[model samples]
Target: MDGWKVGVLHSQTGCLALAERGPLNGTLMAIEEINAAGGVAGRLIEPVVLDTESDENKSAELVHKLIKEESINVVFGGYTSASRKAMLPVIEKSDSLLFYPIFYEGFELSDNVFYTGACPNQYSVPLSEYLFENYGNRFYLIGSNYVFPRESNRILRDLAVQNGGTIIAEKYVPLEATKDVFKPIIQDIAKLKPDVVISTIVGDGIMDLYSAFQDAGISSDEIPIASMVTSEVEIEKMGHAAAAGHIVAASYFDTIDSPENAKFVSNYKSKFGQNMRTNMCVESAYCQVHLFAHALNITQSIDTKALRAAVLGAQFNAPQGRIRMDVENHHTHLWSRIGQIEKNGNIQIVAETKGAIEPDPYMIHHAAERWQPSLISGVAK
Candidate 1:
């Protein structure tokens, strides 16, 4: 059988490296497993890796080159919304398949992309409901200045007001800005003292924010932090002491107690290292490969159009649990898990939505709904 080539576009340097490495490693592991099991369609899968260097323009350039020159069958890997958005035009024009494996703010759907990450239903809605049900009516919002955080916090703001919760403060720092160095904003957080803090900060900025929150003597136990972007991998880099006791909501965690997860953990540790941390992105990337392989096998070909159709409605029982793609929005159905960070840099799952939640990219029920139709229609166009 002929070898099928796929491209891995990820940042090995710059801000997103910490998040990208785990997933990239997971993808490699998946490739190894597939090859061991006689490869996809009796063809060895070859991943052509390219470092985006966390530069949006560089990522776009490389993606364009990969699609046109390398003739990669599918492209995978993107950690941030900016990187994904940067590659959109290139992939669309080339009519290439891209398996994006990170969660971001909803309101995007495309025929050229297969999103295996959480959308509003898999992350934001469940998180908002969890906060409202447990903590009373005051909330604070914080994030890095970017499309994902800005859009996601908008939804949070709307949800807070809709559910009778007050947003005491909303703050954002540039991607390269450090939260610890910003004294005035730290002072403001102390002043508002909201009941809950919802953080969407990403990259190295997260360490600064959490450290500053700690230095300001704000206890997570008091004004508990419920973050959409924090994970075990980030905590490992920041140290468990900085991230300990914080609550994080996502579709997957490393500590889920299931045989599938247990084997996944064992295999991952064996392949990577005992100290390696697994997060939602890693699991999603790993699952994406297997899911793609499943679809390819079912269709019995690697034809782009056929594969896209197969992926749109594909369902699989992944290590994280059952996942299905929602045809309308091109997002995924995934179970939401809320985990508390432990001192050992591990997240312990405290609560989980019973089953996979359907993706709602347009967010039809929120005040944001007014803008959804227009945005989705434009995307469709």
Candidate 2:
């Protein structure tokens, strides 16, 4: 809506800077397109952008200000789980809506939130199945010291063990850890010799980890690396030579071949700049804005509760593919794609799920599911 204000919360100057900028830009792009095409419901979407600075505490404060002071209707931002978690209390207390657009570990559900992103089913499960089928049954986990990476690794480890894969080494490094710090970790990994390395390290940590792995002579051809967070945005930051041959799983990529995506890419390049790259987070933000617009149009109102109700079980043909919100989990059911980072900084979708996998936030199907349905159910209540 032309006069409607939305909060754009992201880290424009911290560890998540590279990852968050794309989505923020993408959200802006969607808003611009909607405005140019006669706006949403004859209202132009105006975003009051706030910088979280990759600080969880700062994010919480910003969310409070955005909701209370700015009186923004919805917040759509944050790249890491930590930032989202930090903003949760504020959102819950204020009863404000947050459309979080990022794939994350499945163990959370909130009525005050619309997670238009992949959960475990959209990434972990499919990736685990792929590794089990193609690669041998040995794995190692590496990640930044954060809730998303830790929880993701736990789920991955459980999946690997359940699927007859063995976890040889699991390590975590602080988000700001130096490159030399990972050398010994790489040495340990080399000794343990896992068949595949599943890494969740983000930002600078990823550069260090990958560089260490390469310097230690641990090539992807020898011990392939698969990551949940590394995407076109991060790969571009790390440079092609450093990221080549690594596998990554996500719901969207810049290279997706579809008429809708082609148009999206063309429009994105034109709006953001030809040198800019698109990634899953950006696509998810774009999808979220469109979905929100659809809900508003269908209901013809911006009542938070009504919008939530309208969105709960809604499905939309997003640019990436068809996506539906899982009422039980509050996460979007989406198709997962496994892509390889080529030497040219482009992703090649090597494999994808046959259909959209339902988001299982409570992990009902897995035997060692860490979260209880009651926890998520209570949170939503």
Candidate 3:
């Protein structure tokens, strides 16, 4: 078959498989849709998928292989911040393009990568504001002991202090920590009686965190756990009872109302499974492919420079809405939303931006009169 070969580098197995598979599936679904619609520039997008097995070294290695060995130009993958960091040097060294489809702890940017997920300003600031307004002034920050968690918590801590709120306590546990590791933290939360728990925990370890919280008999309504991390993908693994009533700040949810979203969700479920779910990351992956196709059709070349030029100012009618790539930064403009995780792995959105919010990756531009801080410490929000 005459086609363009793109590399797929997300995990399909191992620890993060539950959440990571959704992104890979979404990428494939979009490629299939584009192919069925006569392909990009009349040639199918043939993806060469490589599973990283949730390993940082593996991520870097696979990206290198895709670029160096396979001679692929465009790739889509990387979930954890660690994986992105691990894969960066290789992505830049070869001048290949990587479409990262996850919300991250901002502060760093690359000429070789395009960020499709929400920027820190899009997810973090609005989420912090919502929590402080609806929940309470006292906050407990917790997350996995990794780049994303540490950086995410740094923003939350500052926001807590900036918003007339106080950080009661902050903590981090291992990525592979079990429920036992969170028992003590739960004890501290119970004792301190913070109004809300702002968790940035990621991967399978977060299930342990939520399970520990549930085992403690602590209800979310009384003091909810808010995060940009938890999504329908994780909730599906942890079960509705384990994940219900929690808060999630994101760019996309299956419950979003729009013809584009309705079709995206229906197509995704039809391609994957009826029991499957969608989230911010999955939607970003799906959008990235369509955007890549759009840019490819315009530029008609996989040359990184030409493709980058085409993508930098491109726009696509995405599942989240009509999103546009930032002309200055490579990140995409996206809708911001805060939703509560409901039963059956659904997210009930509580707060949302009126329209697509532009990219402010450094978190320096979208300042409120209340927030004069300039993110000088490399914090995400």
Q: Which is the leading candidate under TM-score?
A: 3
Q: Is candidate 1 or candidate 3 better by lDDT?
A: 3
Per lDDT, what order, best first?
A: 3, 1, 2
lDDT of 2 at 316: 75
Pick the lDDT winner. 3
TM-score of each: 0.93, 0.92, 0.94
Clashes of each: 0, 4, 0
CA error at residue 293 for candidate 2, angstroms: 0.4
Q: Candidate 3's residue-wise lDDT over 135-214, tens digit each?
A: 88899999888777787778877777777889889899998888899999999999999988988888787788888889
In model 3, the runs with Cα more than 4 Å from the true position are 370-381
Candidate 1: global Cα-lDDT? 0.81
List where candidate 2 sits over 4 angstroms from the true fold: 367-381
Better of 1 and 3 by TM-score: 3
Query: Whose lDDT is higher: candidate 2's or candidate 3's?
Result: 3
Error of 3 at 218 (Å): 1.0
| RMSD (Å) per prediction | 5.8, 5.9, 4.2
